[model samples]
Target: MNTYHIDAYKDDIYTCVRSRCGFCFHACPVFLSKGFETYTSRGKCMIMKAFLEGKLPASQGLADRFALCTTCGYCTSVCDVDRPEIFNAFREDLRDAGYTIHRHDEIKETVEKQHSPYGSPDESLASRFAWKIDHGSPLLYYAGCTARYRERAIAEAMMMVLPSFDFLEEAMCCGSVLYRTGYRDDAMRQARALVSRIERYSTVVTTCAGCYKTLTRDYPVMGLQIRPEVLHSTQYLVREYKEGRLALSPVGKGTKVTYHDPCHLGRGTGEYDAPRILLEAMGYEVIEMEHAREMALCCGAGGGLKSINDTMATRIGSMRMDEAKRTGASLLVTACPFCVRNLRDAGGSELDVVDITELIAQSARHEK
Candidate 1:
């Protein structure tokens, strides 16, 4: 019998262990922030190999080391292996062994009970924006947990920019958090429940990057496909703008703003241009960060790292903030609310961070 869940990744892990290229170390958010090899993709592969070889025992220390990753896929960008997949699987193995992170457990429990990791029933956030929900509309807006509870502006901006769209009466966790944190079974349950709730709509749009990826990509991977078409708010906005259906007033007279790609949106789903196109449409000058598009740095809150190790998450976020500041841009914008929250926390008073939806909403010309 396989000793650990990561046994499935043995070939890939062995390849990394033998290669020792260390290419993934270049910009791995956790490795960069923690300044340790154990946090990098190659390093994690080594740990997996040790476990498979029966040289390392499953323990909280080992679990903590694996939990440090942001699951950003930067390593996969440069290397051939799917590091995030391997890391997430390893986390599952650790979880099976009862070596899970405390905070992650709490998040999983809260999500299972409240249907949201934010520790409240879905009704709480939906009621705050009850005026936005319209069952008659075909287009439904899914403001993922972070946007609904943490970054209200993104959801509000999405509704403000869209002339008419339906909002789900209750907030639902997309299960992206649970999936990334090694609760695959629970994540699948949430996915099925959420798909059932929103499958009635003809079209579904979401303002959160994580939610967009989960709805469009991850769900299908789990063999549960969404019935309606799912579009990220940026994708929908850009398409509308292109068709002349949406009018955007110039928000900046060429004011420079840097864009940060949420890992899930950019690499996870290969959505790189929609958000930038929307930014340019709003008349804002787009400044490219050194690590933009496919190679963009993670905001540090992904893969449940923020909940598990906030200090390290913030440190990694600060590194991205520093990169944004170097461009001398006046503002920093990203599609993911989780990115906005973490970047804003790290960038406070140093650089301005806003969701792209907020800027687009500001530039939208609503019919009076």
Candidate 2:
């Protein structure tokens, strides 16, 4: 029987076990919601130590505890020591011990069979690029699964905002869903496939935070070499605006708008300024949420948590919406399609949630 082991993470496990600092306690959304130490990073590390030392056996309950995390990287952002690595290692250990989440398994099967985690047979390689443009540029706009299927408006808005990029006709899953759900080998395979598809492009632009992070950060970490430079659409827009490639129409003065930093975009990649800069340039009053930038709260759609327990995900997203409400902004804008989807679902009638690209496209000034 395969058993949980921490040999690779011995140093991090020891540090977390010995310190018990609780620095990462409040940073974990799961811990805050569950009100249990077990849901916190430090607590999870302790559980890993126990399993490694043979004091505890790998069980479904333990697996569930690890799954509670959204893996937003907030704990690691605030921790003096590396917390994300230890948490991820524990997840891998859980999978190795014959424990895995059913939803994650389903996602893996879907991605393997359909090239999408959504399990929709309608979404094929051909359908992904049905809106392709032959701009004759070496730039490829990779509308990831979320943007392509779930948040079609974001993809359409991206095309409107920049009508000169080629869409990848053969883009597959970015494997972020697989990696975050502890299917490392499957994620690696997806990464290899994705790299081969876009390596010829000079730049790969993505509208999904998960895809941006996966291509720019996770792929290299997994030893997959993607030759093209990766840029988030927000980042690319900022450059376009700076280089006079794109023009924006200013909104009415005092038009209040707030920005929600998507986990993978803000904390995961430290890109909190470009979107705000664009908003400010568009003449909207960019109000900062109480938990803005590095400390921004997640929209609860990440790390496959939405698939596992949608009720919990909705609750978390509602909490974020409440914060956005506190800002007194008429609109809540985010750079990620996933964030827009969850925030819109949770915001309901109370708030209006929109992707930055949508806002930009609507306000774009087309020069005749």
Candidate 3:
């Protein structure tokens, strides 16, 4: 067995180290916040190269540097190298070498015990939304950890807009943070457990970009084939609107709002238009930020960075918030609940931050 995950990507690591194109530098959220080439994808590739060449040993300091990444994949957007995959593999190698970050280790433990990194939810979903659930419905609404625990309103909004759907009685973690933080084995175990519970559903919809990406992309890559079709809430809602099965009541009434594409949903899954379409349908004039869609900046909360180094994460999020403000929009809307939480933390009272589903719930007239 290959003890080091990076061994599978030796050639790719060498390619990044040799190219040294710096295409991934200025746009890297960690690099932008830390002002260090070591935080850039190429710079990290150089570190991996050094490790492979036996020049650098795995150490606590090295692990901390690797943990700073948001895994946003912006580097891969500009270049041929799959930087996020390589970086994640390198993190696994570091973890196996006993250089794991403390917070990440705690999270792994929490997820193993509680099925969540955010701890037990303050309230039970079954108690809160039991009346709205249809247990026999083919469609299931999966409220991911952050939505169920931290941003309850996003889940509530999704329930208000969705018609005839069943919900998981309790929110599950989905192992996104574990997978991103170098606990792939633990993540796989969690994935298998969650997969067994939801495979009966024909479709699983969620308001979290992180959970959508994990279930649709990462789970399969980890060799756990999910049976249900996974759709981000934006994708599901837009389809209903386009098919004339859903109605919107012009809640925005021409108010200008800018959309921020979540990294996992946009760069990870190639979903760029659904959220914007839904926003426009609800009567909001959409403004394009300087960095929107493919080139959009990360909200700085993904890949366990928020738990590891919150100050740096908030600084990077504040930068994205500034970009939204420059567009002169009154509200900043996004599809993912995680994006809303981090951007809100960074922006504070400066501008309103909302999930697309939240805005949709306000405008929905439930034509069906």
**The best candidate in terms of TM-score:** 3
Per-candidate TM-scores read: 0.96, 0.94, 0.97
List where candidate 3 sits over 4 angstroms from the true fold.
Answer: 1-3
Q: Mind giving the per-residue lDDT tens digits that candidate 2 earns over 85-115?
A: 5666677788887899988898899899878
- The sequence of per-residue lDDT tens digits that candidate 3 reaches over residues 1-368 is 33568878888888877777888986799999989899998889899889888889889888889989999999989886668878888888888888998988998998998888887657665576777889999999998989888899998989888877898776577999988988888988888889999989999999999999999988878888988889999999888888888998899886999999999999999999999888888889999999988899999998889987789889999999999999999999998888898999998589999998888888887674
**Clashing pairs in model 1?**
none
Q: Rate the local accuracy (lDDT) of all candidates.
A: 0.86, 0.82, 0.88
Model 1 clash tally?
0
Compose the digit string of candidate 1's lDDT tens values, residues 1-368.
66666777788999888989998988899889878898889888888888888899889999888888888899998886778878888899999988999899999999999888998644565565567667788899888888887788787788777777787666579999999888889999999999899878998999888888888877887899889999998998888888878888888767999999999899988999999888887788999999999889999989888887789889999999999999999999899999998998887579999999988878887534
The TM-score, computed over Cα atoms with residue i paired to residue i, of candidate 2 is 0.94
Which residue window of length 10 is worst by lDDT in model 3?
A: 119-128
> How many backbone clashes can be found in candidate 2?
0
- Candidate 2 colliding pairs: none
Worst 10 residues of 2 by lDDT: 121-130
